[model samples]
Target: MRIELVQLENIRSHVKSTVPFTRGFNCLVGGLGCGKSSVLYAIDFALFGDPLGRSYNYLLREDAETGKVTVQFSQNGKSYTISRGLKRRGKGISQDFDQLKLLEGEKLVASVKSEAVAEQLKAITGLDKDVFREIVWVRQERLKELLDAKPRERQKRLDELFGLSDYEKAWSNLAGYQREYEGEKRAYEKDPDVIGMEKLNMEYNQTAEEFSRLEIELQGIAKKLEEARKTLEEADLKLKELEEIRNLTEELKRKEAQLQVNLTNIEDASAGLAGKIEEKKNLIENFKQRLSTAENRLNPTRLGSRK
Candidate 1:
């Protein structure tokens, strides 16, 4: 896992700051009280919600009302971002206001509360807080703490980092199983039932034969059940297709009704327009007749005028 960015707001001495990291060997160097360590803590808080078991109230700035941390990192070539917020409740008390969001390129894939966020982060980055602090983060003051630790402590840290603890657990489980098996074996050997081993062997062989026959019957039943399931699935698919066809038929009927209404509206409009055209034609004919009558009245012969 590689950190790409760490942002802090109202965390410890930092008001607002962002640090971008490169691919390899990025360092944080600054004077005292400049929030160099706070950046690391902010990264921890953003990923794990709480910073290394510290209280949320102590991590928030004294004068600030809220604190926020956002960290962007890349693991296995996929980018992720985590953001967390702490809001002051009253004097010397603060509560986690924001749930942790695991985002991939602005799309939230998981959101978890503070209690379960650490485990999610561990699963995502393959490192818990202890392994992270031990391997990735080295404080300026306690840089030699890992080296100066006792052998058991150092080995424990190493075991966690290298996953040797799983091996230890496996060994412990194997020893326990061995002890259990030995005890069972000793009990079987010391039992008085071993004296009638021949009779017990005949009974065991008979039971095994019965079990084999039942197993065959069970397999036949399972095969029939699988075939029945397939038939049911086919029937379900056909039902769905039938439902879709019914819906389409209803939609077609609705569209046909709408088409008929549109056709009726068009016929009404056409009839109204034809009526107006006929009225205009009658007015033109009347005007022509009136002009002809006036012409006939104005004729010279009809008025009895000299030539």
Candidate 2:
């Protein structure tokens, strides 16, 4: 929707001027006396039901003058017209002090009923003020206000702009899951490997069995190693004793060889001496035999003297 012309009668400084507008980037530039911004306010009134949520006549050209505004615009490729008239008597009283007329194409489909007719006019125009503000309503002053806003106010504005409500819901769900995970962690942190309370007693039985097996194996190995070490020490002692016996046996064999040689030499010399003695005895026996023979011959001589 786009507005082309806005006629303000006794509305602010517009007086009776039909302020022309453009479809895009429209600027109403003039000196301070000219109603440049007042023209913008006139368009604002036609769409906003009331310009500033107050009486439309408050922005009229003069206090005593009757206030009326007419806006011509294009909606959905069709030309439309909306008109509002304001009364000055009731300043803040609730009464039918305003009127609205809407014309669609070449027909007046929206009829005027109650005088305070901004709502009825909107129903005919199908124009949402919020949508209009988004596209066309802006000011440098408003930009400054937003930029200079407080941190909390800016946060609210940013939330409204980016629609962060869904993130809040997701965070709540994540928090719920985190709480559940923490609960599960706490439950099983120190839990035994046993399956159930009834089966838990089997843990002690199995552990005791394993402990007995390990103890038996360890004792066997210890005994084997101790026996091996003791055998090694005993073998070392026996080897030393055998070495001493071998040395003594070798010495005794050498002494026996020397004693046997001495005994053989003594036997040879003594046998020679004994043989010489026997020969001397034989010679004495031969001399005795010769002397006996001579005596026998001499006995015959005594008888043979006279021969």
Which model scores highest in TM-score?
A: 1
- Tens-place lDDT per residue, model 2, 1-307, is 7888888887777557787788677777789967776666667766555555555545665654467778898866888887766665655422223356677766765545543344645665665565455335655576577689998887776577555777998999999999999998777755665246436668778888999999999999999999999999999999999999999999999999998898888888788877887787787777788888988989899889968
Each prediction's whole-model lDDT (CA): 0.82, 0.71
Clashing pairs in 2: 10-60, 10-61, 11-60, 11-61, 12-59, 12-60, 98-115
| Per-candidate alpha-carbon RMSD to the true structure | 20.7, 32.6
lDDT of 1 by residue, 189-304 (tens): 87778757857989999999999999999999999999999999999999999999999999999999999999999999999999999999999999989998888878867668
User: Stretches of candidate 1 above 4 Å error?
Assistant: 140-143, 160-307
Q: How many backbone clashes does candidate 1 have?
A: 0
Pick the lDDT winner: 1
